[model samples]
Target: MIVKRITNVFFRYALRVITLLFAVSVIGFTLVSLSPVDPVQQYVLSVGSVSPEQRAELEDYWGLNDPPVERFENCLSAILHGDFGTSLLYRRPVIDVIREKFANTFALMLCAWVFSGVIGFILGCVMGANRDRAADKILKRICLLLCSVPTFWLGLLLLLLFSVWLGWFPIGFSSPIGVMNSDVTIWQQIHHLILPALTLSLLSFANVALHTRQKLIDVLESDYVLFAKARGESKRQIMKRHGYRNIIMPALTLQFASFAELFGGSVLAENVFSYPGLGSAVSAAGLNSDVPLLLGITLFSALFVFTGNMIANLLYGAIDPQIKESYANE
Candidate 1:
């Protein structure tokens, strides 16, 4: 049975990845095609004044002069060979740019996700358990207020209050590279992360708290929960063994989806903070019409979201045996 479950999970995950790749390809191709300026023009414009012959030469060099189908085929071939092509603006390999900035973004995202998930789950569980109590009411009102504020506005407000007003941390970017171990303590590093991570976490926390509260409420009212209660199970035992177990599966699914949103949302937040991350990289590439960099970032982000969702689905089945049994029947 375990072997069968594992096989099923892998099969579903494989299908999800394939679907994700297809969707990403379609979206990337369509958006690029719809843009008014061609990469050749943008490339020439970036390189200063150029003669018509030079423009034609550049187009031919990059295969941009090819028919649309041929150009797409060439692009795909290059991508398959791990050649993201050169950035016209940066004059560097697209992969090099991504590699340089991806770590900061990933680290920021990791911290934000962990903080949001843990805090949101705890707050949500408490609110659900207490229902209409004062604490629940207060939490719900706070969540609603947070949700009402735009993430960009909230980030700016936090920056103003913490960095500008209080002088707590640096305004932008990751810690300087190549520091001796002694220059910055662990506490200092964490202090530097507080603003960006908090900005990102606020949005995620509101979302998770709302979803978790709703899911937990539903789970608490389910027939299984009622039966557990009727069996003279202690409230604590019922919550730990039954209520939490069931409520958490859906919450986990929502949280995974929220992580994907965090990546997308990071673009704006990163820009606001002047953070040197993938989001900022993509924004720069877009303004510069750097197709390779743009496509690479889009594909990378789509992969992250797809993989997260696939893992969530597998986890859902694992945590809930009925899900597996239903899948087996199907």
Candidate 2:
């Protein structure tokens, strides 16, 4: 029965992924096709005036003269074969360019996620446990204020206060002098990440705290919780074993959605900090009208969102036996 249930889950996940990939491919192709500027023309303009023969040759090389549907089909084929095509601006394979910058973005995202989830969860649990008290009210107000603040503005404020005024860390990308200095160790790398990570974490933390507080409040009000309380279960035991456990699935759902927002949000943060991440790379690609690079970044981001949601669904089953049983029945 467990094997059957797992197989069904895997099948559903695969179907969803395949459908999402197709949808993304269609949307990407459509958007690119509808753009007024021809990539070939843009390339020609960037390269200065070219002879008619040179223009034709460039178009032929890029297969730009091919029918739109044929071009899209070719693109899909290339993507399926793990060939992301070449970037017009960089003159390099899109996959290679993305791979080079992925680590920086991943590191920043991981730090932000950890800080947001851990801190936010703890604060939220405290507030929820306290319920209508002064501490709960204060925490709620703080989270609301944090949510209202713009991420970019907050990032700038942190940059000015910490990096500029205090002289605590380098202001920008992996040290303007490069990462090779003997003084620049792993701890130094983490120190530099502090501002950007904090800036990114603020919004995520607020979201998690708000969601967790709401979910915990709802869970605490449930009949099972009340019954446990009546049975003389200690508050700590009830919260730890029942309340927190039940809230985990909902929290995981919100976290998955946050992953999508983080990619776009990180772009602004990366710009402010001059971080050498995929967000910065995407921004550069957009400015340069590097279609392949832009597509690569977009597709990569889509993949992240898709995979995160899948993991969240699986986690629901693991954390909530009721959810697993319901799925098994289906």
Candidate 3:
């Protein structure tokens, strides 16, 4: 019975993912169709002028001669067969380019995600426990300031201060210049990552910190917390036992939901820093109208976001057994 229930849950989740992906693909393709940039013309301009015959061949090659519906059908068919189509910009398979770019983006995002969560949670806890005090007031002002700053603007300022003026870090890129990719050390990559990751972290942590602070405040004022205080539990003891237990789940949910925001911010962050990541790739694809690449990225992002939410849902079962029982009944 347990196995069957788990199977049912998995099946439902799978169907939802499929439906979501299909919808994303349709919407992405429609948007691309509406875009004014002509991929073939862009390609020709990049490669210099071509004869009328050659232009016709290029249009045929990209299936620009076909009806929109037919082209979409062909694209869907290729996707089903594990081909995301070749990128007009890179002249490479969309998936292959995405894979390479996403590796760098993932590393950047992972660093930002960890730093934001850790710093935010800690700050939130401090502010919540010390409400109306200097610490809380100072942190609240900082969060508000940081939240208002744009990601790209922050990246540029950090780059100028730390890299240009202070000469503490390299200006931009994922790795050091004048070094072969194969020869670049892990530390080199990390050094380049610091500014962009910091920018993203600073921008993102505010949301988590504020959300957590409010949640902790609520939990602290609850009846059980008052009872604990009456029972002679120290402030620290009450927080350690109850405050953390109640707030952790909500914090996790917020963190996971922030993936979409993180992805969006990364675009600005990468462009500002000239980092070769999925975000930068997205910028290039859009500017050049690389439909295959753009559509592929759109679908991937949808999947990425859905997967994050799904993981959060699954974790609820592990974190709270009542949630698990509810899932089983469903």
Candidate 4:
């Protein structure tokens, strides 16, 4: 019975993900089609002008003469067969480019995610535990300020302060220029990564911290906590016995749900730092009207975010048996 329930849950989420991908593909393709950028014209500018005959051949080759529905159908068919089509901007297979760019992006986001979660949770705990003390008041003000600052603006400021003024990190890019890829050590990559990751982390952690603080405070005000206080239980003791569990689940939900925001922010962060990741690639694809590349990225991103939400739900069941039983019964 338990196995069957788990299978049902998995199947349900799987179907939802499929439907979401299809919708995203349709919407992305429609938007790209409506974009004013003429991909062929952009390509021509990149490669120098071509004769009218050559231009016509290019259009026929790309199936630009076909109806939008026909073109989308053909593209969908090819994708189902494991072909993502070629990128107009990079002139490489879309899958290949995405693979390379996604690796860089994954590293940057992972660092930011970990840092944000850890720092935010710690700050939230501190603020909640201290209440209206000086420490809490100071951190709350800082979080409020950070919540208002844009990610790109933060990246720029970090760029100027750390890279330009302090000269502690590189100005930009995933690695130092002129150095062969093979010669780039792990430390070199990390050095370049610090500012971008820090920028993203700082931009991301405030919401988590603020949410966690409020949740903790609510837990502190619960009847059970008041009863414990009347029983002469110290604040620290009650927090240890009652606080962590109650607040953690909500904080976990918030943390996991941040995957999409981090992904979106990476685009602005990556572009600001000139990092060669999916964010930069997507930007180029949009600017140049690389339909296949843009659509592929859109579909992939939808799956990515959907997976995060699914994982959060699954974690909830794992961490709480009551939740699992309810799901099983459903």
All models: lDDT?
0.83, 0.85, 0.92, 0.91
Ten contiguous residues minimizing lDDT sum, candidate 3 = 321-330
Full candidate order by lDDT, most accurate first = 3, 4, 2, 1
Task: Name the top lDDT candidate.
Answer: 3
Q: Give the better candidate number (1 or 3) by TM-score.
A: 3
TM-scores, each model vs. reference: 0.90, 0.92, 0.97, 0.96
Candidate 1 residues 1-330, lDDT tens each? 768967877887788787777678777977898887478877777668999998888778877667878878888878888897887767899888888788878888889998899899988999988899999999999999988888889989999998899988777766635677468676766666778889899988888888888888888889988998899988899889987887787878888877578987789889988888998999988887888888888888888888787778777776778987787776
Q: Which residue pairs clash in candidate 2?
A: none
If both were scored by TM-score, which would come out higher, candidate 1 or candidate 4?
4
Clashes of each: 0, 0, 0, 0
| Stretches of model 4 off by over 4 angstroms after superposition | none
For candidate 2, the lDDT comes to 0.85
After superposition, the stretches of candidate 3 with alpha carbons farther than 4 Å from their true spots are 328-330
Q: Write the per-residue lDDT of candidate 2 for residues 22-97, one digit (tens) a residue.
A: 8887898789778764677768877898999999998898888899989998989999999998888778899888
Among residues 3 or more apart in sequence or in different chains, the pairs in candidate 4 whose N, CA or C atoms overlap within 3 Å are none
lDDT of 4 by residue, 133-240 (tens): 999999999999999999999999999999999999999899999999999999999999999999989988999999999999999999999999999999889999
